[model samples]
Target: MFKISRRKSVNLSIAVALSFIAVVAVIAVLIPFAWENTPYFSKLVNDVVINESQQLGRCVFFVWLYICFAIVEACCVMVFVLLIRVRKGLVFSEISVDCLRYISWLCMLLSLFLFVGEIFHPLMFVMAMAVVFLGLCLRVTKNVIELATSIKQEHDFTI
Candidate 1:
C-alpha cells in the first residue's frame, strides 16, 4: 500500500518537462553542427552548395528549421504550464483547455513547415508526419479537457 502524493507526481513531471526543454534547446543550438554529417541535411549550409542562390536557400532553410525547433520549445513550455495547472487542481478548467489548444495548433503549424521542408531534406517528411500525429493527439486531448471543463462548470452551477 504505497502511493505517491499528487504534489510529488507533479514535481516529477515538471522535472521531466524541464529536461525535455533543456535537451531540445541544446539540440536546436547544435542543429547546424549536425547538418554537416547527414547527406540530406548537408545540402544546405555546406560548400557543396556553391551557388549564391543555393547559399541563400540554405540559410533560409536552416532558419526555418530553427523556427521549427522554437515551436517545439514553445510546446514544451505549454506542457510545463499545463502540468502546473494540474498541480494546482485546475486540470478541468478553461485555461488548461486553452493551453492544450495552443499546443495543438503549434504542432500543426510546425508540421506544415516541415512538410514544405521535405523538398530540401527527406527527413523533413518523416518529421512532418510525426508532428502531425502529435498534433492530432493533442487535439484529441484538448477536446477531452474542454468536455471535462464544461461538465465541471455545470456541476459547480448545479451546486
Candidate 2:
C-alpha cells in the first residue's frame, strides 16, 4: 500500500490544475489552426466582419491570432515547468526563478501584442491593461521569491 502526505496531495492537486491549463492552452492554439475549416469559427469570423469594418484581411487576422496563441502556449509550458519544480520542492531554486521570469516576460509580450491589436479593435486595450497588470504582479512575485531564496541560503551557511 502507498500513502500520500498532505503536502504531496496538495502538489498533486496543483499539478492537475497545471495540466488542465496546459491542455486548454494547446486547444486554444489548435483551434486557430483548424479555424478555416471549422464552420463555427467561420461563422464567428462572419459575425466579426458584420460588426466591424472588413479592412482587416482574414490572413492578417489569423496570423495575429496564431501569434497570440503561440505566446500563450509558451507561457503555459513555462508554468508547467514551474509546477514540476514545485512538486520536487525546488520552489526557491534558480531554475524556478528563471521560469517565473520567462512567464512574466511572456505576459509582457502578450500585453504589448494586445496593445498593438487595440489599434484595430478597441476592446483589446482593456485586455492589454489586464495582461500588463498580471505581468507586473508576476515580476514582483519573482523578485520576492529570489530574495527569500537568497536569505535562506545565507542563513543555512551561517549555521
How many backbone clashes can be found in candidate 1?
Answer: 0
Which pairs clash in model 2? none
Residue lDDT tens for model 1, 1-159: 888988998999999999999999998888778776776666444443433576577687778878888898999999999999998898998899999999999999999999977766667899899999999999999998899889989999999
Pairs clashing within candidate 1: none
What lDDT score is found at residue 56 in candidate 2?
49
Tell me the alpha-carbon RMSD of every candidate.
3.4, 4.9
Give me candidate 2's TM-score against the actual structure: 0.74
- Reference-based lDDT, each prediction: 0.86, 0.80
Overall local distance difference test of candidate 2? 0.80
For all predicted structures, in order, the TM-scores are 0.82, 0.74
Largest TM-score belongs to which candidate?
1
